[model samples]
Target: MIRHAVLAATCAMALFAGAHDGLNRWTQDAVLPPLLHETSVEVRARGGELLRAFPVEDGRWRLATRIADVDPTYIEALLAYEDKRFFQHRGVDARALIRASWQALWNGRIVSGGSTLTMQVARLLENGRTGSWSGKLRQMQLALALEQRLSKEEILTLYLTHAPFGGNLEGVRAASYAYFGKGPKRLTPAQIALLVTLPQAPEARRPDRGARVAQAARDAALERLEEAGVFHSEATSAARRTAVSSSLKPFPATAFHTTERARLEQPEQAQILLTLDAGLQNRLESLAASHLNRLEPNVTIALMVADHTSGEILASVGSAAEIDDTARKAYIDMTRATRSPGSALKPLVYAMAFDLGLAHPETLIKDAPVRFGTYTPSNFDGQFRGEIKLREALQLSLNIPVVSLLERIGPERFMQRLERAGLQPQLQGSKAGLAVGLGGVGLSLHDLVTLYASFAQHGRAVTLSQYAPQPTSGQRVTASAAAWQVGEILSSAPLENAQLNHGIAFKTGTSYGYRDNWALGYDGRYVVGVWVGRADGTPMQQAFARSTAAPLLAQVFQYVAPQIAPLAPPPPETLIVSNAQLPQPLQRFETRDALKRADASRPDIVFPPSGARLAADPELPLILKLRGGTPPYAVFANGEIKALGLHSREASLGPMTQGFFELSVVDAEGRATRASIEIR
Candidate 1:
C-alpha cells in the first residue's frame, strides 16, 4: 500500500511538471506579446520629463509602455504589505499557500489570498477576474509562466503599471497625481502606505470617497511594514496617524494646446516629447487667465515665447482658456489665426530699407499725411509729427514715413523678402500694395514672432520649432548690420505709461478698428509675442497694442527674465550717426518727384510689353510698369478705369482671365499707352 501511494505521488508530480511546461509555452506564444506592447499615455516637456498623462481606454491609466521604476521606499512598503517573500519565491509562496488553504478549509470559506506580487500582476493582466477556484488556479499557472519569462523587477513593473488605485486611476503615478498633485517619485510615508494598500480594494478604500476606510487600509499597510522591520514602530505609528486626503486634486493641465497638438502629430506613439517649458507655460497660462477674466466675455489672448538663438517654442498659450462658455470661439487657437498685423511689421520694412541703403537711422523723413494716389494713410492718433529722424518715425510708429519707404522698396519686393524669411502674409489680393506697410495684410502671430526672432538673431531667419531643437544655420533674411540697427532703435522705443521697462526691444501693433492688438519683443536669448482681441472679429474700444498687449508682454518677460540674458551690442557694421553727420543720400528721404528727372517723358508699359503672351499663372504678380509717368496715373482695363491715381510707376492687374485683354494706362498728362497680353 505504501509503494502504491509513493507511485501515485510521483505520477502527480510528473503531471504537474507537464502542466507547468504547457502553461509556460502558452504564455510565451499567446500572452506576453500583447501584454508587452500595452499602450501608455505620456506627454513630455522639453527635457523629456513627464508633462501629463491620460488613460488608454475605459479610464485605466496604465503607464505600461515603459518599465515603472518606483521609489525604493514605496517598493519596500508594497512588498511588506502585499507579499513578504516576493523575491524568494518564483511566483507563489508554498508555505503561505498551504497555510491559507488550511485556514480556508477550517473556516469553510476562503480566508486570505496567498498570491505573490507576480501572481497579482498575472491576475491584473488577465483583467483581475478570479471568480471561481478554477480561475484562481489559472492565475497561479500564469504567474508561474510569467516568472520564467520576466525578471522580478519586470514583474513588479507590470504590477505597478496596472495596479488599481481608485476610481479611474490605475497606476501609482496616476494615483499620486490625482490625490497629491505630484508624481510618484517622491511620496510621504503615509502616501506610500496608502498607495501600497489601494490595489486590493481600490473603490472601498478610495481616499477621496471614503477617508475613514482609506485610513484604516493605510494603517493596516503601515502595521505590516513595521512588523516586517521595513519601517520603525514610531514611524509606522506616525504614518498611521496621518489623515487621508478627502479631496482629489486636479492634474497638471499646463500647455494643454501644445500637448494636444503633439498627440495629434504622433497618434500611435505612447510617449511624445515637445519643446515646451512647464514652468513658463504655467506662469503664462495663469497670467492669461487672470487678465482675460477682467476683459469682455468675447475677448481672448494668445501668446508664444521662443528661444531667440534656437527658435524653440518655449511657451505657447493658444488661448486664454481652452474651454469657456462665455468666450466666443474659445477653442480657436489664435496664435495660428491670420489677422491684420498693423504696425508690428514696420521694423522689417525699416530693416529692409536700411539693408538696401535707402535710409539711415538719423535720416530725416516726413510723417505728414501722405497719399499713395487716392489712398491716404493717417497716423494712429490722426496727428502728424512733420519731419522726424527715421529712428524717431519708426519708434513713434509713424505711418506716412513707413508707407513712403515701402513704396521705395516696392511692395512686391518687400513682401517677397518677408516670404523668403518664412512669413506667409495674407495679402488682400494676389499682389502687394503700399498699404501692406501699415498692417493692411494678414499674418498669423506665429509668422510675426518668427519674423521678429530673425531680427533678434541678427537677420538669420530660423524657422520656429515646436517639438525639436533648431539648428543654427538658417536663411539670411536681411543684412546683419540692418538687423542690428533696427534692434538698437526699437530697444529705446517710447514705452506707454502701462508698459514695463524690461530693456527689451519690442514693437506693438493695433489692427484696423482695434480688431487685433499685438506686441512682439526680443532680448538676447528670447522672443515673446502676445495677441489680445476678440476671436469673433468684434472690435474692442480700448484694445491698443501699447496699452493692452505690451503690458502683458512685459509681464511675461518679467516672469522669465531670470532665465534670459541682456541684448548684445550692435555689430561692427552698424552705423551710428548723428543727423548732421549723415551721408548725402542718407541726410533726408527724397520725395517721389524729388528723385525724378525734369526731362522724364510720357509713361509707357515697360513690362508685359505690347503683344507679350503672359503665362496664365505667373508665380509673381502680373506687373504692369511704366518708364516715366507723372505722379498719380490712371490704370484702365478694357477701357474701364480699374485703378485711378496710382502714385507708383507700377500697377498690379491681379491674375487675369485666360482670354485676350487690353491693359491701358493714362499718364498724369492724359497720354494713353496700351498693351495687349494673352494668357495661355
Candidate 2:
C-alpha cells in the first residue's frame, strides 16, 4: 500500500511538471520577447537625467534604462524579508509554498506569498500581481523560464529594475534618489529597509502618502532582517526608530543645456558621460541665479569654467533661467551665441604684439585719440593716458592703444591667427577693421574663453571639450614668453573688490551698445568666462563688464579657490623691467609723430623689394621694411598715408585690396622713395 501511494505521488509530480513546461512553451514566443525589450529609461549625465523618450503607450510609467547594481547589504535585507530561500529555489520555494498553503488552509484565506525573487520579477514584468489562480500559475512558469534563460544576477537586476516603488518611481535607484536625494549604493539602514518594503504594496506604503504605513512596512522588513541574522538586533531597532522621508526630493539638474545638446547630437545613445563636475556646476548655477535676481528682469547670464590643461568644460551655465516668461528667448544658449566681445580680444592682441616682437610689457604705447581713416578710436572713458606702458594700458583696458596695436598687427592678420588657433570671430563685413580691437566683431563666449585659456596654457590654444580629456598638444597661439608677459600684466590689474585677493589674470569687455558684458579669467589650473546681458539683444543700462561681469567672475574664482594654484612662473626670456629700462624701440610704442626727428636722408624699401611678386589675399598684410630711414619717417600706400611712426625701419601697410598700389616712404627731411607692388 505504501509503494502504491508513492507511485501515485510520483505520477502526479510528473503530470504537474509536464503542465508547467507546456504553459512556458506556449507563452515563450508570445510574451517573453516583449518583456525582454521594454522601453529604456532616459540617458543620464553625472547622476543627472539627460533625456527621457518613454513610449506614450506605456502609461507614462517610469522605467529604468539600466539597473544600478544593488548594495549587498540591501540584497541581503531584501532576500531576508521577501524570500528566505531565494538562492536555493529555482523560481518558487517549495517549503515556503507548503507553509503558506497550510496557513491559508487554517485561516480560511491567503496569508502570505511563496513567490521567490525571480517569481516576483516575472510578476513585475507582466505589470503587477493578478489575484486569479491562473495568473499565479502563469507567473510560476514564467519565473522558471526566466531562471533557465538568465543568470542569477540578471534575475535580480530585473527585479530591482522593474519593481514599482510608489507613484512614478520604479527601481531601487529611483526610489533612493527620490526619497533621499542620492543613489542607493551608500544607503542608510532605514533607507534600505524602506526600499525593500515598498514594492509589496507600493501605493499603500508610499511614504509621501502615508508616513505611518511606510514606517511600519520598513520596520516590518527590518524585523525580518533581524530575525534572519542579516542585520543585528540593535541596528534593526535603530532603523525602526528612524523616520522615513515623507517627501520626494528632486534629482540633480546640472548642465541641462549641455546634456540636451549631447542627446540631440547622439539621439540613439542611452547614456552620455560628460566631463562636467556636478558639484561645481551646481554652485555656478546657484551663483548665476542669485546674480540674475539682483539684475534687471529678462537679463540672462551665461558662464563656463574649464580646466586649462585638459580643456574640459568642467561647468557650464547656459543662461540664468533656462525657461521663463519674463526673459524672451531665455532658452538661447549664450555661450555659443555670436555677440560682440568688445575689449576682451585686446589681451590676445597684446600677446600677438609681444609674440611678433612689436612691443614688450614696459613698452610705452599711446592711449590718446587715434584715427584710422574715417574711424577714430578713443579710450573707454574718452580720456587718454597719453603715453602709458603697454602693460599698464592693457591692465587699464585702454581702447586706443589696442586699436593702434591691432593696426600694426593688421586686423586681417590678427583674425587669421585667431582662426588658426581655433577661434571664429564674426566680422561685420567681409573685411576686418581697427574697430575689431574694441568689440567691433562678434564672438561667442565659448571661443572667447578658449582664446583666453591659451594664456594659461603657455600660449597653446586648447580645444574646448564637453566630454572626456582632450589632447594636451594644441596649436601654438603665441610665444610662451609673450603669453607670460600678458599673464603677468593681467594678473596685476586691480580686482573690482581689491580685498579678495586671488591671483587671477583676467580681462573684461563691454560690447558695442552694451549688448554684452564679458569677463574672462584664469589661475594656474582653471579658466572661467562670464557673460551678462539681455537675451533679446536689448542693451542693459550701465551694464559694463567691470561693474557687472568682473565681480561675478571673482566670486566664481572664490568658489573654486581650493582647486587653483599659483600661475606658473614667467618664462626665462620674459622681460620684467621698468619703463626707463626698456630698449629704445621698446621704450615707446609710437606711431608716425611720436618718434624723434628723422635724419635728412632718403629711405629705401627693403621688402617686397620693388619688383617682388606678392599675393594679394586681403588676409595678408604687407610688412614693409625700410633701410637708411631716419628716426621718424612717413609711409604711404597707394598715395594714402598708411602710418606716421618711423622709429623702426618696418611698418605694417594693412591688407591691400587686390590691385596695383604704390608704396612710398617720406623722411622728415622731405627725401622720398617709392615702390610699385601688384596683388595677384
Candidate 3:
C-alpha cells in the first residue's frame, strides 16, 4: 500500500545528514534477506490448474507467483494506486518524501507515511517494526540497496511473496486462492483493490473476520483510483458494487495421494507439472468417495485412466476420501498395492496364443474339464460350453479355455511378454505357471492398466507416467495382428451401456477367495483400470468383478469419456476368417501335451503347409495329396466330410470355391493333420 503523506521536517533533515555520513556506508554493505525461500510445493495439471498444494516449512501458505502469471489489469491498477511513479523512481521517490514532509508541516495532525512499495518490501523481508525513525531509516537504506541489486520486477515479486494476508496466508497467490477460490491470474477491480490494500493492514481488514471494514477499505481505495483516473469510471463502479467473499476456500486436494507421492519423491521441487486433467481427476475422486459407505468398512475403491498413445496418466484416484476416516484405511494407496489380478490377465494370455500362431479368434476351443499336472481350473460359473470360438470363450470368461491356451504358450513366456507390455509382475511363485492364467500372480492396478494399454497401442508398450508424459517404448508385447485380434474379440464382450455408442474392450476378474475385484478396459486411445477391495486384503466372498468393479469401470468411462472413439482397424496381418474357413491346425485348440503325444504312428500333411497360396482353376477339382496316415483315411474340407473312409494315398476335394479352404484328413486312429491352401 502507498503512504502519501507522513513525515517530520526535522527528521527528514536529520535523515538527509545521516545518509551523507554513515547511511551511505550502510547501504553499500546492506545484507539482503534470503530471497530464495521455500514456497508451497504444488502439483499442477497440464493447463496449470492446481491439483494439490502443500504448506511451506513454517506451515504457511506462500505459493510462488511470477509477474506474467498475474493479470495485467491488476498490475496496472496496483502501480497507479500504490506507486504512481513505480517504474521511474529508482527505489525512494524524493518528490513524494518532500511532499509528505510539507503536508505534516501544513496539517495539524499526522497523515500517511511516505513509504514506497520498495520500502514496504524491505520491512516485510526483515520483519522490522516501522513506527520508529531508526526502523524507517533502515527500510529506506535497504530499499535503495535492493533497487541497486535487483530489477524492478524482482522487487515487485518479493513483495508479492512476502506480503502478509490474514491467517497464515503470506503471498498474493495464497490469498487469491483462499479468498477467491482461484489463482491471481484474473481478478476483478474490487478484488485487486482489496489485495493492494491488505498488505498494509492484513488482519484488521480480513474479509472473513470483518466484512464491513474490508468492504469500506476496498471501496475507499477504488474511489481514490477513480479520482486519479487510474481506472475507467465503469470499472470503478462495478468494483464498488462487487462483494468480497466473507469466507475462505480451502486449497484444492484433487489428486491428494498423487501429489503426496510426488512431493515425497522430490522434496526440493517447488512445483511439479503432471499429465492429468484437473476436471476429470476431480470427478473420479468424487466417484471414489461416493462408494466409501456403500461397501464393507475398510473397503477402498481405486481407479486410473491413461492415454495409450502417450502413456500419460490422465487421472488417478488412489483411494476414497481419507479425511479422518480411519475405518476405510484411506491412507493406503491401493492403485499401487500388489494384489491378485485373477481373470483380468486372461486377455494377455489369449493375445500371446495368437502371437505364437496357436489360435485365431474364430477358432473353436473345447472348454472341457482339463488338468495341468495337479492344477485343474474351472469356469466362474462352474459350467462349460462344450465347444466355442475363442471370442465367445473369452467373452464368457471360461477359465479352462484360457488355461488350456496358456498351457500351450507356456506361462514363462507369458510372464516375459508381460514385461514387454510394461508390467513387471511380482509373482508369488518363483516362476510363472498355468495357475498364473487365473491371477496367481501379484500385480497392481497400474500394472494391469499398462498391460491393457498395450493392446490399445497395437502391441507396442510404454510406461505410464504421472509426473510427465513418457515416450512410446515401441516394445512389442504381442504381434500387431494378435493385439488387434484380441481387442476385436474383447470389444464384443456384452458389457455395452446405453451411454456409449462405440464399444470398449474390457475384462473383469475376481481373485481366488475374492481377495480382489478388478476390471481393465480400453477404447481407441485410453485405458481404464478399476479395483475394489479392502486395503488389508480381507476376502469379500460375495464380491465379484462383473458386478462390482466392472460397473465402476463403466461408470468411469461414462464420467470421463462416455463417447469414446471406436477401436482402430484390425492390423494388416490380422486374419479375418470363420471357424470353418480357418487353417486346419488353427481351427482346433491343440494342447501342448497333445502335440507332445504325437508320434510317427500319427498322421501328417506333407503338402500345402499353411500360408501357401495356389494359382489353380476354381472350376477344376484340386488334388489334395497326403503322405503319412492310417490305411483307411477320412478326408474333410471345411469341417464337412469331403471324402471319408477312403483307403488311398491321396484324395481330390474342393472343386467349387476359389477362396481359401481348410483341408484335413483324419486317420482311423482319429489323429488328424490340416493344411490351408488358396486358389487364385
Candidate 4:
C-alpha cells in the first residue's frame, strides 16, 4: 500500500513538473556534508585499558565507535523497530514514509518517525531540520548519496557515533558508559532498551533529568521489540519492569597526573598508550588518598613502582588525589619535584667505594666525629660508634662513615657517575662537596628510583619512562659486585615490623632539617621509592624516614607485589669474608689524611705496613713498630693479647707463629691499628 502511494505521488509530481528527468534529479540534488567528526581522546594503559578520556571540541562526549563495538542484540531490535525493510531499501523506505505521512495527516500531529537509519545519519551529518517537506526531501537525497558512498556497516557506525543521549553525551559507547557505568559491548536487556530509544528525544527522555519519562520511552521500545518478535514476550516484559537509572556515572580518570600530562603533550593522539598497570595505578591512587589523613595538614605523599629489568613504570602517585585542602599542595607532582635526598645517597657512595677497591663489606672504618675545616658530618641521631664495618655503616645509614668515603670518592665524581647513568642530580651551587652525599644535593623521586634500579639491574641503570617499552642503553653505574653487596647489606637492615620481610633490600633517609623523608627499595625485578613531606619543603619535626616514608613504601609493596621477590644474589667478584680474612689494605679504610686528623696522636702502624711477608725462623722475631699515641701499648696476636703494659714504642713479638695472623696494637687511649701479615 505504501509503495503504491509513493508511485501515485510520483505520478502527481509528473503532472506538475517533468516526468523521468525530474524524478532522477530528485534524490541526487542535495549536497553532502563532512562525514568524519572529532572524537574524544583516550589515555590507555598497557593492554588497552582506558585510564582517562577527554571530551571533544564543544565539550561533547563523542567517542569513536564501530558496528562490532555494540551489542548485536540491541542492533537487531533497533533495525526491527526503526525500519523493518532497512536492508532492502537504498536509503529511504517508501512503506514507512507513506504510513508516517498518512498517520500525521489523519491525526494532525507527528507520531512514529519515518526516517530510516541512513536518513537519520544524513540529518545528523548535515544538522538539518526534520518535520518539514523540504528538510525530508534533502535528507532523502543526502541519504541516497551516503548509501552510494559508504557501506551499510559504515552508515550504521555513523548513526552509532553521532546519536545523542543527553547533555554532552554523544555516541552509543559514551551513553552506555555515562548511564550504566560500562561499555556497550554487552548490555543488559533493560540497558539495551534504554540505549535503543534514547536517541529519539535525548533531552526529553534523559534518565538523569526525569527517570519516569526515560523509563516510559524504554518500556515503549521493549513493547515494540516484543510485537516485532525481536525479543521474547516474557523477556520484553521483564525489561519493561526494570527501572531506569536516575544518575550518570562519571568516567574513569585514573593516573590523573600522568594521563593529563600525556594528553597535553600529545593532543593530536586519539589513543595514548602508557606503561602503567591500570589496576595497580588505581589501587595506589586510592591508597595515596586514604593514607594522607595520618600526616600533617601540609604534608603530601608520593610513590613510584617500576620494573627495573624493563624500565617500565608500573604505578606512580604524584600526590593525594582526593584532598581538597589547599595547604597540602595536592596539585603538585611530587614524583618529579626536586628535594634533598638525605641519607638515601649513602648506598650509592658505598657502591662506588666497593667498585674502586677502596673498601669491602668487612673493611673497618671509624664512625667518630671528623672535621673538614669548619664543616663536620655526624650520624643522624648525633651519636656515633668509634669503629664499624662498611656493611654495618651502610645498613645503619651512618652519616660519618659515608661522608668519609665520599671524601675519598670525590663528590664531583659521584655526581658525574649519576649523570652518566641518566640521572641529573641538582647541586646547590657550582661545586660538589662531601655534604652532597648527605643532603647537600637535590633529587626528585624519579632520579632516586632510577638510580636505585641500577642496583637491582646489576649496576646498570635503565632509563625509567611512562611510555611504551623502549630499548635502553643500560649505562653501567658501578660494578655488579658492588651493587650486589650494597643490596645484600640493605636486605639485613632492621625494619619497623620485625616479621615484615618481603625480600626487598630497602633504605630510608631523612634530610638535615627533617624536611624531606624517603624510603627506596628494590627486589630482583622491581624497584620502589616513596617520599613524604610538605610540597613547600618546610620542616616537619619528627618526620623521619623510618617513621614516615618507610611505612608507606612497605605498604605499597604489600599491595602491588604480594609475593616476595628475592634480592639479587651477590655477583661473582663479591668478596664475602670476616674482617680478619680481608686483604691487608682492605682490612681497614685508613686514608693517609685520616692519620693526621683531630688526633695526630692516634695509633699508627709504621712498619710491616700490611700484607707483609716475613721470615718464620724461630730465632728471627718480628718487631712491632708504632709512631703515634702514648709509649705504653698492648699488642694482640691472633685471638690473644700477647703483650701488656709495654712502655717501649718498639716490642718484639711473633717469633714462633708460622702461619698468617691478624695483629693489632692498642694505644693507651684504647684506639687500635690493625695489620694482616703472612709468615713463610
Best by TM-score: 3
Model 3, residue 232: distance off in Å is 6.1
TM-score sort, best first: 3, 4, 1, 2
Candidate lDDT scores, in order, read 0.79, 0.77, 0.82, 0.83
Question: Which 10 consecutive positions of candidate 4 have the poorest summed lDDT?
Answer: 7-16
Cα-based lDDT at residue 348, candidate 3: 91
Better of 2 and 3 by lDDT: 3
> Whole-model lDDT, candidate 1?
0.79
State in Å the error of residue 418, model 4.
1.5
Q: Estimate, for each residue in 249-296, the C-alpha lDDT of model 3 and write its tens digit.
A: 989888777888888888778889898899899889888888767776
**Pairs that clash in candidate 1:** 342-439
Shift of residue 628 alpha carbon in model 1, Å: 12
> What lDDT is reached at residue 478 by model 2?
94
Kindly list the per-residue Cα lDDT of model 2 for residues 401-456, writing each as its tens digit: 88888878898888887886788888779898888888878789999899988899
Clashing pairs in 3: 6-112
lDDT of 4 at 629: 77
Over 398-448, each residue of candidate 4 has an lDDT whose tens digit, in order, gives: 888988898888989999988977788888799998899887898999999
Task: Judge candidate 4 at residue 58 and give its lDDT.
Answer: 96
